[model samples]
Structure formats: C-alpha cells, structure tokens
Target: MFGDMMGMMSKLKEAQAKVEETKKRLDTVLVDEKSSDDLLKITLTANRTIKSIDIDDELLQDKEQLEDYLILTLNKALEKATNINEAELAAAAKDGMPNIPGMNF
Candidate 1:
C-alpha cells in the first residue's frame, strides 16, 4: 500500500511540473486573428491575454464599424487561444501520464 501511495505521489508531482511548463509555454504562444473584411486584426496569447490590435486607417473614421470589427476580431482571437490552450493542456496531461487504462488523461 505504501508503494502504491508513493507511485501516485510521484505521478502527481510530475503532473504539476508539466502544468507549470505548459503555463510558461502559453505565455509565449501568440495567436493572430483578422476580421473577414481584413480591416481589423488582433493578437492574443494562448492564455487569452490581448497583446495588440491593428485597424485600417479608413475604419477610424467610422466608430460603429470600427467597434463591430474590433469585436469580431477579438472574439476570433479569443476562440483560437482557447483551442490552443485546450490542446496544450491535453499534451501536458499526456506527458505526465503515459498509459493508464480507462483514464482520460
């Protein structure tokens, strides 16, 4: 029983380490997304933090249009970041545990 507990503790430690590593990598993962009209662009990290945004000069003249495009672009960037985050987490979980039957991770 002690051996089993030790093994479980070791796996937990390894999982924690992998989670930390994933967070570090997420900080460096930048995802860029653009509006359909190509008038707006946004860059965000996999952790869903906005980094930068670019808007066409013409759009600056129309506040409503600019706001709409900005919203669209931001949503796309955030969604992409979410997908990347999920993938990274899955990879980290896999790295932490090689094969455990019936276990999703």
Candidate 2:
C-alpha cells in the first residue's frame, strides 16, 4: 500500500510539471496579424499582451480611417491570439490532463 501511494504521488508530481511546462511553452508563442490592406499591423504575445503596432504613412493621412483600421487590426490580432492560445492549451491538456474540473478552456 505504501508503495502504491508513492507511485501515485510521483505521477501527480509529473503531471504538475507537465502543466507548468505547457504554460511556459504557451507563453513563448507570439502572434502577428495585419489589416487595412496591410497598412495596419498588430503584434501580441501568447499571454494576450499587445507587443507592438505598425501603421502605414498613407493611413495617417486620414485620422478617422487610421483610427478605424487601428481598432480593427488590434481586434483581429486579439482574436487570433485567443484562438491560438486556446488551441495550444487544449492540445496540451488533451494529451495528458483530460479536462480536469475548474480548469477552463
């Protein structure tokens, strides 16, 4: 019985380590997306932090359009980041975790 308990404890530790590693790997993934005919671009980290922005000279000629394109590109980058993060976490969990309670997607 003691040996069985030790074995289970070891397995739990391994699973926890895997989870932490997956989180680290996810953080390394960066996503970039463009909009407004490639005049607007947004970069984001896997943790959903916006890293940088690029706007074309022509877009700045019209403040209204620039604002709109900025908003659109940021939104698109965020959306893409969300999708990537979810897919990565889901894939990682599927391989080992198998959907534990309270660990949302």
Candidate 3:
C-alpha cells in the first residue's frame, strides 16, 4: 500500500512540473490578428493579454468605423489566444496522465 502511495505521489509531482513548464511556454506565445480589410491589427499573448493595437490612419476620421474595427480585431485576437491556451492545456494534461494500459486521460 505504501508503495502505491509513493508511485501516485511521484506521478502528481511530474504533472505539477509539466503544468509549470506549460505556463512558462504560454507566457512566450504571441498571436497577431488583423481585420478582414487589414485596417486594424492586434497582438496578444496566449494568456489573452493584449500587447499592442494598430489602426489605419484613414479610419481615424470616422469614430464609428474605428470602434467597429477595433472591436472586430480585438475579438479575433482574443479568440485566437483562447484557442491556443486551450490546446496547450490539453497537451499538458495528456503529457501528465499516468501511464496505465486500457486507460485514457
């Protein structure tokens, strides 16, 4: 019984290490997205934190157009970031799963 407990603890430690490594990798992931017309662009981290935004000078003259472009571009960037995050998490979980025959994570 004690040996089984020790093996479980070892697996837990490995999973924790993999999670930390994945978090570090996520911090370095950058995603850039642009609007359909290429009038607006945004950059964000996999953690969904915006790094920068760019807008075309022509759009500055129209507040409504600029707002619309910003919203659309930002949403695209955020969605990409969210997808990346989800994929990374799933990969980490798969890597951390205990090795057992006839079992799936």
As a TM-score, model 3 comes out at: 0.87
**Model 1 lDDT per residue over 1-105, tens place:** 688778877887898799889988998999999988888888889999999888899899999989989887898899899999999988897788634558875
Off by over 4 Å in 2: 1-13, 98-105
Q: Give the poorly placed runs of model 3, Cα more than 4 Å off.
A: 99-103
Global lDDT for candidate 1? 0.87
Q: What would the TM-scores of all predictions be? A: 0.88, 0.71, 0.87
Error of 3 at 22 (Å): 0.9
Better candidate number, 2 or 3, judged by lDDT:
3
Pairs that collide, model 1: none
Candidate order by TM-score, highest to lowest? 1, 3, 2
The number of the candidate with the highest TM-score is 1
Give the lDDT ranking, best first.
1, 3, 2
lDDT, candidate 2, 1-105, per-residue tens: 687777756655666677678778867788998984899888888768888888889998999999999888888888888888877766665555433458654
TM-score of 2: 0.71
Give per-candidate clash totals. 0, 0, 0
